[model samples]
Target: MAQSWQRSYADMKVRDLEFMVGERVLLKVSPMNGVMRFGKKGKLSPRYIGSFEIVKSIGEVLYQLALPSGLSCVHPVFHISILKKYHQGGAHVIQWDSMLLDQKLTFEEVTILDRPIQNSRSKDIASVKV
Candidate 1:
């Protein structure tokens, strides 16, 4: 019975989310300092600040994200409403060497340095001799 249940769940197709951990995504974020005139001038800026890795899921509404610039931050676990996927060209067209050069940080670097500040602090203290 357990096996059957698991199989059914696995067969279900999850909606392809626009943003995922380790995915290079472009966010249509609004600048915090922009002037709002009559609410009609609100604009979204398509700024690509490298890639972000999702660290943890805070319930179903929030996610902890690690930015490429080595900053850890949380973002609203927005439904597909506010996120868009950045599609790199097809595999057939892009070469592996070029793709590697474009990446600013390796996966290991992101995994190690992009953790929450609290976590990083604890690790740092452990490394230092008391």
Candidate 2:
């Protein structure tokens, strides 16, 4: 006798993406500043500080992120647009103090230094002229 009703889809194809609880992932946000705040002004300040590990998935969309500061929060369903593969490289391991001391540093430090100047410019633009 022949077997009846063979499975159409392969088992490998049906497997869910395996993400561990403590897997480090980079949380991405738009440059619009208030996008993550969900329409609230002056409350949300979004920037790429560093990578956060996945604490757990609340459901299908929402995920709990464990920040480096040892704080965790569950909200914000991060789509693929905001997610990028966290590349482990020399750039990620360089200490702030060491970078400041090193004469030859990576390009990432340029942005870190530039941010303060950018903030100052914004403050000047927002200030009322006497």
Model number with the top TM-score: 2
Candidate 2 clash pair list: none
lDDT of 1: 0.39
Positional deviation of 29 in candidate 2, in angstroms?
A: 4.1
Q: Which 10-residue window of candidate 2 scores lowest in summed lDDT?
A: 99-108
lDDT score for candidate 2 against the true structure: 0.42
State the lDDT of candidate 2 residue by residue for 1-130, as single tens digits: 1232234344535544445567766654333443432222354433333466677766664666664322223243454334444657626432322222111111122222222222463463333222
Look at candidate 1 and give me any clashing residue pairs.
Answer: none
TM-score of each: 0.30, 0.35
What TM-score number comes out for model 1?
Answer: 0.30
Q: Encode model 1's per-residue lDDT on 1-130: one tens digit a residue.
A: 9999998898785555534456544433333345332222434322233334465555554455554332223233433433455566533221222212112212111123333333463464223211
